[model samples]
Target chain A: MLSAGIDIGSRTIECVVIEDGAIREIRQAPTTFDPRGQIENVLAGVSFDRIMATGYGRNLFEVAYDAKTVTEIKAYGRGARHLFPEATTILDIGGQDSKCIILGPGGKVQRFEMNDRCAAGTGKFLEVMAEALNFSLEEFGPSALKAGKVLTINAMCTVFAESEVTSLISRGENREDIALGLHLAVVKRAAGMIRRLWPGGPIFFAGGVARNSCIQHLLEKDLQVPVIVPDNPQMVGALGAALLLEEGA
Target chain B: MFGLFGSATPNSNERYGMTIYDDHYLGGIEERVIRDTETARAAGAKVVGVYCAFTPKELIAAAGAIPVALCSGSDFPIPLAEQHLPRNLCALIKSSYGHAIGDSCPYFRATDLLIADATCDGKKKMFELLGRKRPLYLLQLPQTSATAESHAYWLGELRRIKVILEEETGTVITDDAIRKQIRLYNRLRTIVHEAFLLNTGPIPLLSGRELDTVTSVAGFELNLETRIAEITAALGEIKERDKDDDYIASVAGRPRILLTGCPTTNRKVLHLLEDCGGIVVAMESCGGLKTVGGLVPEQGDPLKNLAANYLSIPCACMTPNKARLDLLLAIIRDYRIDGVVELTWDGCHTYNVESFQVEECVQATGLPYLHVITDYSENDTGQLKTRIEAFLELLN
Candidate 1:
């Protein structure tokens, strides 16, 4: 039997198909203005017996395709546990929102917290700050890691932080230092949410934001614990949905 | 078939239990009451507008005046209110002040006098401004309900309010009148409380949205007898439908949620919770079970009884608010609640800070808890949905 899971996020869509217990195919695409069209493009030739949807646009996908839906929190918990069986805590920072989930003994969500209607600690904040500082998204993380010292950024609002960055630049502050400061701000927010849920432990960090090396390094250093990142962080939700279907959950 | 409030008639085929007392009927009643209030006011009937649950409606009834809730629950007048009030105030205060100054809200327009309780700083300062536009009376409520001096001060405030009511309505408020109003209000509260308790059964007869509409409309009804009859009939319909095996099976396993926090006047969070597939079996807010759960002593001094009953309301404004935590734990067990969702408005510092103790209390009972801080706006609906859905996942 084959199972499929599609995570339709605000910025991207990830589709994972698994046969029996092994991954068969993985596909992804940008979720442009027309998400339905983008979703159709992502699943062009994927075939599966059972399918599930999870993410911000899961309800729309459920209605349009008559498929089952699960919240990203549960999907991430299950996905993280499947990848690392001993994982008890997970932090997922997607494009528009971030969440901290603590799993029970059997990989059930015990408690969770998400950012409240803001882009302060999510990948979108990093993307906006990258543009303001004239750094490519690819180069943003490595450049921040190369800074000698970190500048302090107090504003959590994306718009205010962007202006703060600009002023710092005009004052002849090092660009790498400003980038490091912004990364530190995001890391502080994510760390605060995780700390609120769990004590010191290895955290399974998964999402598009986890791809940024600066955030991962700062998170591990600041929290004084290992931050585990899977090979394909963005596909965790999709993989979890598919695995849940395989388990007949 | 009123056009102003849309159709007051319910589509017979909507849902099984809610066909009798749905939003259409409740909304129609609101429109009719507004028109009826205008006619009565022109004929020399006095109307007293109140904002908080602390305002003793029985006192208004004893003074031979109509009591109407003037607390605004919409986002429409907020922009107008922001012109005078700061944008950082609670939405409830902003909306209430906006409706008064903008010449909107028929309930505010029909009032001969407005009464406000000094519950929070935002509301107290806003009442000072509201006094300029209308004949407003402020009740100096003691912050704590734990002291003998506070009780005496609250009783004195009630007595002063009685004098103001008599002077405003030109009617003598005797002890006999106060006792009669208390008895009538006690009966009303009992029926409403019973209606809310109907959800405690294995399967809820009415959804949270339907229950909220019934209670909100019942709050504004001038005729206690009429309100009691309407709600009693609705309860009968729900009870009869609860016996259906198919209906019970259809809604069997949804997680039951208990809401506790600031008054959910706007119902944004309530709608989001139900929309995310969880059943809000109980609400501990002002407009919910909190106001109706307690009753006044019939044999005691009527004025002192009114003061004591209203003072013990367990609102966040009261320091040493241990009563609220106790009430929440009782509701959680009695309602068989699977989780607790506490919603505090953005600027409501009292409830916002009190959420810490509430969270600790809920987690102690081995139930999951979620604290949501938001305003009456649609900007965060997407984010709120994800949070609510994920919270429900914990229950599953």
Candidate 2:
């Protein structure tokens, strides 16, 4: 059976096509304001028996495509468990929000916590700080590794953190240490959210932000647990949506 | 006077057509509140505004005063409150105090007397600020109901209020008058209980919003008989419609949720739950099914009975609120609840602290429980929807 899943996130749209329960093709593009048109363009040549949608803009395409909409939490959990069956806890830090999900036996969401209406510990927060430091988002993690001394960005608010970063630069502090401090701030906020629930067993990290090796390493150090990242962390939600097609959702 | 018959829903032409009730009869009561208060005021009746259900409404009624509730759930007064209290205080308290101090709420202006219960620390201080701007009475409630001493303390508080009421109205509160008011209020409680029991049906005869409106309106309406009649007639329509079991069977499969939380006078979460495949079968919030419906054992002494009835309400302010947990478990069984959703309003320390106990109680029954901590801000709508939807999927 051919099944497809599309994730219309705030920052990106990910399309995953599965054939006979195997991932056939994965594609991604920056999400446009017109999500339906963007999704159509991304999957122009792709065909599937059933289509499912999940993410911030999931509803925008649900009626247009006659697709079933699943919560990003559930979609990420399904995708993570399928990739790493032994994974019990999944932490997905996306553009606008971060989520910590505890998956129970039978892949059920036992419990979960999401960052409240703030962009403090999310990909957007890093994007803002990266812009302030004149570093590409992709270079943030690699540059932070060169720091000798550790620093902590106390303000989790993106705007406040950017000001704090500017002040650190004004004080002639090491740029690498400031970048590392910002990463630590994000990891600390993420750790605090994860601690609210029982964070037992292996932790799987997914989402667009999962590509940050600095965040991945800091999360492991702060949490005192090994973290696992999928081969394509960003496609987890779309992959999970495709997997749900067999369940007749 | 706002016209009642064939009244079009305000802003019905706008997006979301904000109707108070699906039933026209009960919806009429929303508009009738202002008119009813005006009529009572014109008839030389003193209007008493109450902050919480813990204040004995029957006592105020027995004093020949019309008792109306003054709690505001809208965000309009919140900015006004920020001028007085810090923005970090509980939303409900700020809303009430704001409406009173800002001079925006007609109910607050019309109230001849305002009784503010010291249910939590936030309100305890907020009411101090409110007293400066209005004719406010502060009732110090005991934090626990387990001991005889606390009950006696509460009983004395009620006696003190009765004297104050008598002084305000220049009329003595006789035992006969008290008993008469008790009987009438007891009848009103019976009707509220019947409406609550309607939720236990295969498909709830009343939506959480409708039930919340009726119960909250019960506190504000001076005429208990009229409100009782309207609710009973509305219940009749429901029974008539629910005679078809097919529709009930279809809706019965949805997850039955028991909502216990910070005073949710606003139906935002309740409507959202139903919108996301879960039906709120029971609520234990202030002015909700649990606090508003329980009878005041009419056989006992009127004063003691009223005290027991008020204190019997297990608010989060009380320590070791086992009665609340017991009541929650009983309703879970009676309503066949599939899950429990406990919502703690932002900065409400008492409810936030008590959520642990409520979670343990719900978990002991082997039911899934979701603890939603939120404020009145619209920013969390999508996040909350995702949580509720994911929870419903887990239930399935």
Candidate 3:
């Protein structure tokens, strides 16, 4: 039997199809204002017996496609455990939100915390700061890794941090140093959320933001723990959903 | 004098395949209440507005006046209130003050007098400003309810407010009148408490929103007998529906949630919780179990009895608020609650700080607990939906 899972997020859409308990195909698309059209585009040729949806726009997908729905928290917990069988904690910094999940024995979600009603410490924050610094998203993380001394960016708000970034640029500050500071600010907020949950063992980092090497390196340095980023980090939610359907969970 | 008769319609939840009996006879009473308050005022009946649960409603009734709750629970007037108040203040305080100064709340416009208390520093200072616009009377409440001196001081405040009520309404408030009002209010509390307890069944007969609507709308009712009759009728209908086996089967198996914290006047969080698939079986806030859990002694001096009963409420304003924790644990067990969700408004320092102790106490019971700190805004609905859904998943 084959199962399909789709994650319709604020920034992107991911579709994962699995057969015989292994990933068969993975597809992705950018979710503009017309997410329904984007969703149709991503799943044009994928075929599966059972399908599930998860993420910010999962409800819309459920209504439009008559599919089952699960929250991203449960999906991440299941997905991370499937990839690394011994994993007990997971962090996902997506487009507009970040969540830290602590799993109990058998991969049941024990406790979790998410950023409240803001885009301060997520991929959206990085995207905005990258634009303000005139750096492409692909080069933003690699550029930040080259900085020597990090300048402090105290404001975590996206709007305020953008203005702060502009001021730092005007002050003849190195763009690389300011970029590193912005990355550190995001890492600081994410670390605070993880620490509050009292996580132990290795942290399984997923979602679009996990692709940034600077955030992963800074997170390890700040928390003094090993951070694991899976390949195709953005596909974790969709992969988890498909895997959960296979297990009938 | 608000008309009590209205067309009643039962709200159906298609998800559960059941029809929830709606006792919404009290809906749309605001305009009628305003018009009625005007007519009654012209006929020499006084209307007393109050902001906290500490003020004795019986005293206002005994003085031949109507008691209306003036605490603001909306986000509409908050920006207007921010012109004079700080933007960082509690939304409840800001909304209440905004309603008074903006001349928007019909209830505030109808009140001949306003009674407030020193529950917290924010509310106390805001009341000072509110006094400038209306005939406001501040009740000097004792900080601690665990002392004999505190009880005496509270009794003195009640007596002082009683005198003010009499002077303002030009009515003689005798001990007999006080006792009569006490009996009437005690009955009202008993009936309302009984209605709230119906949710303790294996399947709740009324949803949380329905329970909230019934209790809050009933407060606008000035005629005690009519209010009691309407609620009693609604409760009876619910009980009658509970006897049906099919009705019970459809609503069963949802996680039962108990809400505890600041007054859930805005109800955004409450709606979100239910919409996320958890039934809020009990609420321990001011408008819920906290204010209605106890009754005053009928045989004692009325003012002292009122003081003792009202003082014993376990608000976070008290230093050693063990009573609140004790009440929470008891309700958790009695309601068979599957989880606890504590809602605290932003800048409500007392409840905000008290949530730490509440979390520790709740976790010790081996049940899941979630503490939501928010303001009266819809900006966080998406985030709140994810949190609430995830919390409910934890229960499963």
Candidate No. with top TM-score: 1
lDDT of 3 by residue, A57-153 (tens): 8889988989988899999888898898888878999999899999998899999998888788899999988988899998999999999897999
- What digit string (tens of lDDT, one per residue) describes model 2 on residues B1-396? 111101122221131222323345445654677787778779888888888879998899898888888888877789989998888888888888778887888778878878878899999898888778867888889989899999999999999999999999988998778889989988888877787788786667655655676677445666778777766766776565367564365355678888998888665677678777776767888866667568887775899999989987888888768888888988998888888999888889989998988888888888989988877767788778888888888788
Clashing residue pairs, backbone N/CA/C < 3 A, model 3: none
- In order, the interface RMSDs are 0.7, 1.4, 0.6
Model 2 chain A weakest lDDT span, ten residues long: A194-203
Error of 2 at A150 (Å): 1.5
Candidate 1 chain A: worst-modelled 10 consecutive residues by lDDT: A192-201
Would you list the rank order by DockQ, best first?
Answer: 1, 3, 2
lDDT of 2 at A74: 88
Candidates ranked by TM-score, best first?
1, 3, 2
Using lDDT as the measure, the top candidate is 1
lDDT of each structure? Answer: 0.88, 0.81, 0.87
State which candidate, 1 or 3, has the greater TM-score. 1
Which residue pairs clash in candidate 2? none
Stretch of 10 with least lDDT, candidate 3 chain B: B1-10
Model 2 misplaced regions, further than 4 Å: B1-24, B201-203, B217-219, B240-242
Name the regions of candidate 3 deviating beyond 4 angstroms: B1-11, B14-24
> What is the alpha-carbon RMSD of candidate 1 to the true structure?
2.8
